[model samples]
Target: MKRLLKLYLNTFDGLSREVWWLALITLINRAGTMVIPFLSLYLTEDLEFSPSTVGSIMAAFGLGSVVGSWLGGKLTDKIGYYKIMVFSLFVSGLLFVLLQYLKTVLSLSIGIFVLMLVADMFRPAMFVALSAYSKPENKTRSVTLIRLAINLGFSAGPAIGGLIIAGLGYNGLFWVDGITCILATLLLIQLLNPKKSKVLDEVKVEEPYSAYKDKAFIIFLFALFLFGVMFLQYFSTMPIYYRDSHFLTEPEIGLLLGANGFFIFLLEMPLIKWLENTRFNKVILIWFGALLTSLSLLILNFTTWSGILIIGMFLMTVGEMIAFPFANAFALQQAKKGNQGEYMALYSIAFSFAHIFGHKAGLESVSVYGFDNTWYIFTAVGVLCMFLLLILKQFLKAKNIIS
Candidate 1:
């Protein structure tokens, strides 16, 4: 136990103060993330929107994300991450509050699109800020630290959100979500002033790279996109599964989802730290993690027992712990100093694309083919993603990008 504690503590030793502040801001913003988890339910039950309309609104969210990511990247390069982060956070807060008043399908759809467009602008900028704040060697650990904050907030967010919905209804969630975004922005302004900070100073790159022109990186992003499609179903379809198949309550469903975040918060930092010291190829580690994630879904076909749910969630958490931080670090490595924002923006866009297609596809599949077959489809996606990664691995080797 003493040795375990020491190892966990050591994972945090080398990250900069800016990274911690960034992580804290992320925690604050995400802690009030009450709406997305319950968005489909709210639209369907309260607003009496049809399933098709809900699907379209969700798709709009993804479309906005793609646009936001591109615009954010361009702005971050032209202006700086500081301004983008501040503007995105502040405006997005206001939009979240405004979203509650839109009753019509058209108004709500457009509102969600605008909300996400502004909200997702923060992502690529945050990645750029992370790169600025972290030391070269500590980059992956720094990513893990930020992820710890995100997962930790997610662990508490859904469960608390469930209780909030019970007491105050869906409207309460919108207010809390909006307020947290504003509060987080204020914290960022107070704690991490770009003018006062030394790291934001521009560094010259001997060879500048364009993210769009990199063939290998495109392949990598495609693979990440596939992985994201499978990963994101936990938000869209799995909750419905828990309710329909096992007859779980809203709070119970929240607890089950929260468990994934809780496990990652406790274990991912140490796990990534240990993996970083190993000789294994990062892509190979990612492939292995993808396989585990696939099996997590595949396990559902074998039994009807509720105990299987715990096992599935555990495997998925471990797989996420292994895959995500290294994937982030690899994306950062691909960027030259001059194009960090562009590269990370494309990286963010990959997952955004997944959100665009994945949730809609998962829901349609579940509706048409039933839950068991939908799990199979996602499992198949994970396997195909692994194959793509393997191709990328060999491609990297041929180019001497990795040894």
Candidate 2:
């Protein structure tokens, strides 16, 4: 116990005050995000929604996110992280209040879609700030801590939400999440100041995304979009998969999905050094692809042991650490001086795009074939992504874009 305590203590010694605040902000935001894990179930079981209806409505939420993410990073650059964070949080909270008025899935979907837009728009700003706060050397650790904080909140939010729905019904979760957002927004309003990055400081003029026409950057963004599809599985398909199998309880499923973030917290720092820089990107993508492929297959072997599923979650997290932050930082680096927000927003777009397609597929595939078959599809996709990334690395290397 003492040795474990000492190691935990030593980990934070590497962090800074900025990192601490960033983690706190993430914690507060996630603490109230009580809806997403159970959203499909809530819409279907609670609201009497059909599977097709829920999937379609949920897919609309992804559509909003697409626009939100594209703007989030740019807003951070222009005004400040604080302002963007403040705007996003409060607006998102307000959107949550509208959930009560839903009578049909159509109404609910529009509400969710708009709320998602507002919420996701500022997410990239927060992330960009988190990334910028860390020294380049510790970027992975920084990203990991934020992911951990989110999971820490995730660990609690679902259980509490479940209880709340049982007691006060689905409306309770919306109200609670809104209140949490309000509190977190106030903290950001208090702590954040108008500041610009060194890159931002160089240009005081308006810069549009079109000004940068780097093909490598475009290709890189598409690569990340493809990679991000696997991530949405945590929410989009996994819960439905559990439901179809009827093998796990809500709490167990939450833990299974939420555990990915926890594993990310555990292994990120030690593993990040291996993920950083150019030479490793190709190898890392391939390694991640194989892991993702194998894990999906293993999942088909058993459906009852959640512990095994959690291990699969861990493998996905390892893949995430390789893919997400590296691609983000790479995108950041690719941006021309003075357009940090625009570039980061673009970088974040892959997630938005991923949702539109990934969720659609996760739903359709699960309905048509089976969740196990979807895993097979994911394995194939992972392999294809690996090849594309390898080719990308080689192209960048030949042209010296990655060095």
Largest TM-score belongs to which candidate?
1
Per-residue lDDT of 392 in model 2 = 71
List the global CA lDDT of all models: 0.88, 0.69
Q: What is the C-alpha RMSD of each candidate to the true structure, in Å?
A: 2.4, 3.9
Off by over 4 Å in 2: 104-107, 195-212, 234-255, 273-314, 336-338, 366-373
Candidate 2 Cα RMSD after full superposition onto the native fold (Å):
3.9
Deviating ranges (above 4 Å) for candidate 1: 1-3, 162-171, 200-203, 243-252
lDDT of 2 by residue, 320-362 (tens): 7666655555664565444666777777677678877887787
* Per-candidate total of colliding backbone pairs: 0, 2
Query: Ten-residue segment with the worst summed lDDT in candidate 1?
Result: 196-205
Clashing pairs in 2: 73-341, 74-341
Task: Please provide, for model 1 over 262-304, each residue's C-alpha lDDT reduced to its tens digit, 9 standing for 90 to 100.
Answer: 7887888888888888998789898988999999999999999
